[model samples]
Target: MHLSIGEAPNGAEGGATTATRPRDAQGTNEPAEPGSPSQTIVTFADFGLDPSILKAVAELGYREPTPIQAQAIPVVMAGKDVMGAAQTGTGKTAGFALPIIHKLLPLASTSTSPARHPVRALIIAPTRELADQIHENVKAYSRHTPLRSAVVFGGVDMKPQTAALRGGVEILTATPGRLLDHVEQKSTNLSQVQILVLDEADRMLDMGFLPDIQRIINLLAAQRQSLMFSATFSPEIRKLARSFLKEPQLIEVARRNALADNVEQTVYRVDGDEAKRAAVASLIRDRALEQVIVFSNTKIGAGRLARQLQKEGLKAEAIHGDKSQQERLQTLEAFKQGEIKVLVATDVAARGLDIVELPAVINYDLPHSPEDYVHRIGRTGRAGASGMALSLMVDKDQRALADIEKLTQRKLTVEALAVTLPGRRGDSREFSADAYRGSGREKRGREGTAARRDSSPDRDRSPPARRSGSSPNRSPAKTDPFFSRPYEPAEDAGVEAAAEPAARNGLRRPARKVAALLGGKP
Candidate 1:
């Protein structure tokens, strides 16, 4: 089905028809039709949420519940596991957080004792940035409630986190590695966890955290409620859900790998790699984007692009796996605070970033996976905000662009950006089909023959060497003068000849006359 922007492709309430919509703004669904689209517009009060939670929600100016939130909150509050798939920026965090906090309110301790809080709820995320973002959201939603929450992720000192856990906390949001560390050190306990939420489960799997997730699940109580949420649920994710969640109500607010309706995606065609960079700079400068995130395929590429942009006098910083946690956090903080105008990143920063009102997201290099393209652009156009996703495409990236289009189920409009830079090597050149076949060997053989002829002293005057059994008309073999045989003087040769063949045959004497005629002794 073709889904427009802001339209949910499937029923929000999993397979259930909206026969029973949540209460409306007036605290009643009296006039609305069953399963009417208006029935989905729910307020915080309609969910039978705690008074404290309602007050917090109102104070935060959240007038209406998002599609995922409206459908998911009730299911989670009813104590049923939920597997939710929605487009990014669809309020997935709050969908689970509100219900989790409301459920945990009663278990919160009234006393000031350190042992009062025993980690009743656990939320695991794939990245520290995402974990931190979720922690902030949970804290905001639970502002009026007595529930205490702590965030623990790598890249910072754990002393504060340990102290927070020991002092008592009702909710804990953490990345897998750091959470496992706490578990091993006995700094935190998961046995009392009544609810478990795995946010961005697919991303966790992509980051190779499946084993850690399995180990973490093994530590949780078997009787607890489990929630799995992701942008797209691949086969592996479905398998994981089957193993972890017990008959979860599958709620998909949008199609799998769907882009947000509000995000306008475009592909800018450039000539070559250098032109791609040039186009990025031009777009940012021309459009005057205040806050932008450019995605590269590799960490090194991200760093290099960031540096190159800086050389062009633009404020840009890169965050990737190679960077230390401190560096990444510092860069992120600076970007959020507007100290850095452009943030260049890899896919690592794609899922967890919650930048508000980000103007644009540029794809410096098209992601290998179409799912990643969704996540990358999902960084912007968040919370029903209008944003632009511009991809710098060259001829070589046609495959990636095609994959993205197929996955999104929509054709992206392509705009040609005028590239003045010289085209890359071989881009402007053409060759015959057999240009490279047997060419090098043939050229080398010809060069070797010419070199031998040029360097030989007699090659030009002498005939070519004849084989051993050649025709008899060929030139006779030249003799070597020095090593033919041992030879006697002329007088000795004459005397020997005369003695042996003088009587039998007429023998001619050698004429060594010059010395014999001049000497009396001769």
Candidate 2:
């Protein structure tokens, strides 16, 4: 039986209903009365969740629902589409996972007659790392339930994924690209999907997955419940919600693009790249940060920083899109297990990383977008834990810093560092920090121009050379491979050519016959 916490006036018909405006955990429409002592500690059992789910939640040591879970769980259980916006580390996954598992448990038990379970729930994430993380959570949450779950994404063997799908799973978490590949290959079926969740909607769009997302949506059952969770609700996100969600309850646990209050943010000003590197290494050593994540704007920068830190006797590893899935996973696990002291990563590779009680996060480079700054610092200060966030800033980052301050509405305290550090062996004084800070697009454009110039026909030309047996008057065949045939001297084909080798050998056909075949006068 499903739990009905609230009644929709329009009723749940055709998967459409008048959703209740989102309220705080207290179940009131107005924001929980300011200073209304933190939400009464409520257990998963009180939320009307299934016994199996309750057991799993307890095993995970979740004493109570977070503000987001408290508000979103009931709405989802009541069969309402939800648009939840909360700061990172707010336990949004459980908010939806618990209800989804509850709804699928009965169906899973009754559908045993079928050879394989039809997919009933589908969650799409933007990156492979995030997809894997969510899949792990689903497995943990549904441990006691009979429902089976699987995850699929790129950067791994498709054969294993196909095998897993053949056996069937009730819940599937996947990246957009890999999921679409499965749909096209007939390896998975989405026609029976009853619940759909788009986690990190903004990140998916940023990675150019909007069209793929729409195509996947078209393949699902028309009467399915849709839920979307994002850190911020930009105009694009709102537009996407409109197209997919049917009167989704707007739930915003925190202000848009707001940094967590528990995170103490500060900026350290340095002279240049060398100084920035020195500041990060010094801070890590001085603060005794055991497990910390350092964010860099580029993959190359991340790698260089990691190696440089290692040379300074700190254990560090770099992860980015260029790394294989296995390598990325191994590095993440090592970091979590305290085997690696520091994990350096680019923005795209670090999304959806669920590290518990990560003590600190360092931003080696300020992100171009202010929203990204929020996400970076969010890696720390999760689950009511206190954490520190530090950013290494130079003069070039002034504009980006200003944008961040404007978005968060708070000025970050900047401390100047005057210490000097050893420069790279091959570093030249002529190289400016701005040279390394160019956007990826500009670098690609310059490389493309150089490639075109190098491949030009004129640049590839070599002085003509006479062949050993050919006459000096004879022109060489055109070297352009795209031409239908080699160029020939037109005069040699006229009537005067009748006196050539073929005529001398008495093997030429009569000109009148050729003319008749060609339908021309002789």
Candidate 3:
């Protein structure tokens, strides 16, 4: 059955329903549809959007409704739980935002202090940038309406967000962590939240925000209208949806967890870790990479790689959670304007970064989870334009690369970089300076899936396991569980996709450098 909104069980007295906004001087739902669709397709007019909101949509150049918006708006306008899975960049925000705005605009009529009224709608984003983007869109859409919106995220001082909260907002957009901080400090109240939206729920799940999300949910009234949007339907996210959504509508615009067809993915297998960097550099230098974002495993790695390339006279910069907010913004702006050739970053830069014409994304280090790999490559090939995503892999990263291949359900062409083996090469110096001092491996801890066991006969022929110092049950080296195992890259059924090098306007594109951080010659 197609994913559609379902009716609530009887005796559900506290649920929210889609209510029309208060009438204007003319008393109409046409907020401002100057050239709006004449009720032929599902337009803001058909969905009962406020005149102010319709005017905002017209001004924003959104003349048509996407498939998701067409299907979702009507159900959401009826005040039912909605679960939508449309592809990225598909204007999914308005599918729910416009309806929510219409339903809440009526509440403003009864408010004694319109300026200080508590927020009626809450939108949870996975990152500050996304939160800001959604707020911008919401503000633009509700410009003519009486709705006031505020965005809150970490990395900035809470004083400003706190002041905004005190000033009272009609719609609140925030990341989970900062939202919880506000709740803890009693700076914001969600007990009156009429509609709750979890945008990019998949990214939130990938970032391990489930607990924080559940905590936020506990503070809200269970009678509120809930909407969830995710790029993929993993088992965990599905479970979360089941617990929260009461017979919710399920909307999937395309296949689940698959990369866009416009994206060209490739994997380059090198002999050693050193070769990985060389391959990346060769691609930039030889291929003439004009604009690129390289994904590294750690903040230190990202910085070091950027600096290393920069010292080699390639323009590059590193950005992560450690960087000051201003620095991060500056780096992002520079990249967007083509001032830098490469922007090296961790997963913080992975999700929700929308660069219209970004040509390439290099996975300097593959992510362990399949979900992360999808997000990392998702930065490019946006807006239905063709783009390239190249991943560098060595012996150690085989498992991670394999996981990525499985997740995408596609096989990446393994291109080997031509390495000139030198006779009697000097012992490789450790690059673990201050700039390189951090573990690239994410700590799975005891929460992740159990470890895999080594069943090879060579293990039985080798030395016995050593006893642990702390307890008799523990081994000196962590033992793989008998059943649960580390990801096996060899056994994966790789996906099928084209890996040809791309050219724009008959130009052989090469990777460009953005910044340097290793404090050494590139």
Q: Tell me, by TM-score, which candidate is best.
A: 2
Looking at model 2, residue 131 earns an lDDT score of 88
lDDT values for all models? 0.76, 0.78, 0.69
The true-versus-predicted C-alpha distance at residue 294 of model 2, in Å, is 0.4
Candidate 2 structure lDDT = 0.78
lDDT value, candidate 1, whole model: 0.76
- Model 3 regions lying over 4 Å from their true place: 1-46, 109-116, 419-522
Off by over 4 Å in 2: 1-41, 110-116, 423-522
Per residue, candidate 3 scores C-alpha lDDT tens digits across 1-522 of 111111111111111212221122232332323432222343556666778878888777676565556556767877788777754455577778888888888876434463458879999999876787778778877888767789999898999999889778889999999999998888888988988999989788878999999998998998999999987777888999998888886765444555767878887665444445656677787768898989988988888788768866889999887888778878877877889898888886645666666788898888767777776676666556678888877667778877776866788777655632221235232221122124533432221121111223453364566666645465456543523455556754421111122243345557787557676554
Top lDDT prediction, candidate number: 2
RMSD after CA superposition, every candidate: 18.8, 12.5, 22.4
How high is each candidate's TM-score?
0.74, 0.74, 0.69
Q: For model 2, give the 10-residue run with minimal summed lDDT.
A: 3-12
Tens digits of per-residue lDDT for model 2, 1-522: 111111111101111113322343364443343432223425567678888888888777777666567667877887889988754467788888899999888788535433558899999999998888889889999998778899999999999999888778899999999999998888999999999999999999999999999999999989999999987789999999999899887776555665667788988776556567777898898889988999999999999899889988999999999999999999988887889999999988998876777889999999999989988887777656789999988778999999999988999987655444542344322212333334645753564465455446786577479678878777667753424445566755644543465567888777553466566885
Candidate 1, 209: how far from true, in Å? 0.5
What does candidate 1's lDDT look like per residue over 167-197, in tens digits? 8898999999999999988899898899999
Q: Sort all candidates by lDDT, best to worst.
A: 2, 1, 3
